[model samples]
Target: MSNLEIRDLHVTVETEAGTKEILKGVDLTINSGETHAIMGPNGSGKSTLAYSIAGHPKYTITQGSVTLDGEDILGLTVDERARAGLFLAMQYPVEVPGVSVSNFLRTAKTAIDGQAPKLRTWARDVNTAMERVDMDPEMANRSLNEGFSGGEKKRHEIVQLELLNPKFAILDETDSGLDIDALRIVSDGVNRYSAQGDRGVLLITHYTRILRYIKPDHVHVFVAGRVAEQGGAELAERLEAEGYDRYVKAARAGV
Candidate 1:
């Protein structure tokens, strides 16, 4: 099925005081070629869920499981999960001072493929990936995400998406901190990547504006770390009109 299944998962972060449970018995599944939007207020554990799935070290999965195509992925390492066909577009991508864009992308492409592409042939494809994302070919020579505009960094992420071609992508607030034109460019690249066959997208956003461009097949309201409600595209419209108070209350009641 090439689908991702997150089954009754609970997450807790360790601290000096003790463990604090964040996600409480969350169950969700997404199949290929579909886009699912996760909308939530702040501190609802939306990003926590995204990072946990991507195998970040801080958040720990205390119970339940996550799987890709029925294979348990909870045991895999961060890079191992990437190689297993999962991608996370962070809200704030890091800046590496010395690493060039081409170098970073080449390493990622190599890791995804599990072997290096021929050096001569690889150079041509890297430029092609840049062009597809509307990135300047000259930027490829600059250090990774260093001294770039907000839009530039976001577009670079899309270039990685095109090059990596992961089966499932969790976009964690990709639309945040962007201007109108930048938002359009970022959404365009996201749409292009989502067009591929059997590629699933799980987009996390606080605003519904980006949904207009990407047109999610389904929309989910995440409250206190679990999906409070789920419906089709119309759900997004309702959220835009009314806001999240009603859903948050319902979620608090365990409805």
Candidate 2:
């Protein structure tokens, strides 16, 4: 039973106007096989938490600790963190001009596993994962995310998620910019990954539409850079019906 634990995590970033704090003492624990949904308004530090956990250098951790299975992850580099079984699906996946999708995926898998996968089996796995995400087979030859549509990029992220099979995954706004069909496909891919019964997922989003397909084991309402309320799936339904107005008001009042 692996666990990702965040204890009083406070993160900040340097901007043109000095440093600005984002996460304000967040504490959460996600054990293997649990899916946690973080819903919040804009600028509420949702992505910051994801990036921080992924070891992005831009975000500075001023206080608190992040641990994976009792091992301190805050001190690990981004690649080291990935090797430790942490994955982050960015909202905007960047383009790699020269790296073919096939090469990139295989290379990442080899690095993580500390061994090169058998050529024939790795090719078969890559093709199977692409088909699972409804991605074109030709995409394997194209440079990663270069000239790809938003929906395609998102699908490609899921492709990586399926093939790499990380211990924990943090998806930041995965449902954004996806059409109905694309959303369903992406959600299905996520569902398949979570079905493994030993992977933890942190799904961050503003809308509850995705929740309809990917039911969260726990829903946390993020407000003012902190979790204001947390409950079961019913909390997500209420947020869908009532919106974040009440949470926003309460956050503003410092309640």
Candidate 3:
């Protein structure tokens, strides 16, 4: 079984004002066959935690260590991290004007596997993944996310997750902008990935709706850049009922 561990993670970013810290001494751990949900209000650093662990250059890790199965990952490059079995499904997937979805997926798969996928098997696999996400097969021929709807983009992200089959997947607001149908589709894809029984998932979201479809093993309430509270699935039920008001007030009052 594999594990992803974050310890005392402090991250910062340069804004117009100056270097502003985003994640304040945050810590989290995700193990194989487990899913963890991070819930909080806006600006509580939920996405920051996801991007920080993915080795985004925009965010700097001032203090902390992120390790995958005892190997230090903070020192790896973004692509290196992907090759190391980490996958990130962005909240807003960027458009690649010239790259077709087919090419992009094959290229990414090759990068992570160190060899190109066999053309026959690769084509069949891509089709299967797209079908699982309810995405049209023709989309594989279009430029990646260039003219797709938000639901399509999110669905494409899931396709990648299935094809790559990473050890750990960090999904940042995947449920955003999704309608009921799209949400269920995306959630099912995520569920299929986690159902592999050896994959870990870190799902970050402001709402618990997605949790209804994909239940998490643990739930964390993030406030003021730290995990103010954490518990089982019941914690998510509480957040859905009480909201983050208590946590927000406590954080502001320095409680």
- Report clashes for each candidate as comma-separated counts: 0, 0, 0
Best by lDDT: 3
Reference-based lDDT, each prediction? 0.89, 0.95, 0.96
Tens-digit per-residue lDDT, 83-190, candidate 1:
999999999999999999988988988888978888888778788877776788889999999998877888888888878989999999999888888788889888
- Give the distance in Å from residue 195's predicted Cα in candidate 2 to where it truly belongs: 0.4
TM-score of each: 0.95, 0.99, 0.99
Instruction: Write one digit per residue (lDDT tens) for candidate 3, span 1-255.
Output: 999999999999999999999999988989999999999999999999999999889999999999999999999999999999999999999999999999999999999999999999999999999999998899999999998999999999999999999999999999999999999999999999999899999999999999999999999999999999999999999988999998899999999
lDDT of 2 at 176: 94
Which TM-score value belongs to model 1? 0.95
Clash pairs (backbone) in predicted model 3: none
Q: Considering only N, C-alpha and C atoms within 3 Å, which residue pairs clash in candidate 1?
A: none
Candidate 2 vs. true structure, TM-score: 0.99
Q: How many Å off is the CA of 118 in candidate 3?
A: 0.6
lDDT of 2 at 122: 88
Better of 1 and 2 by lDDT: 2
Kindly give the stretch of ten consecutive residues in candidate 3 with the minimal lDDT sum. Answer: 238-247
Q: For residues 89-162, what per-residue lDDT tens digits would candidate 2 score against the true structure? A: 99999999999999999899998999999998888988999999899888999999999999999999999999
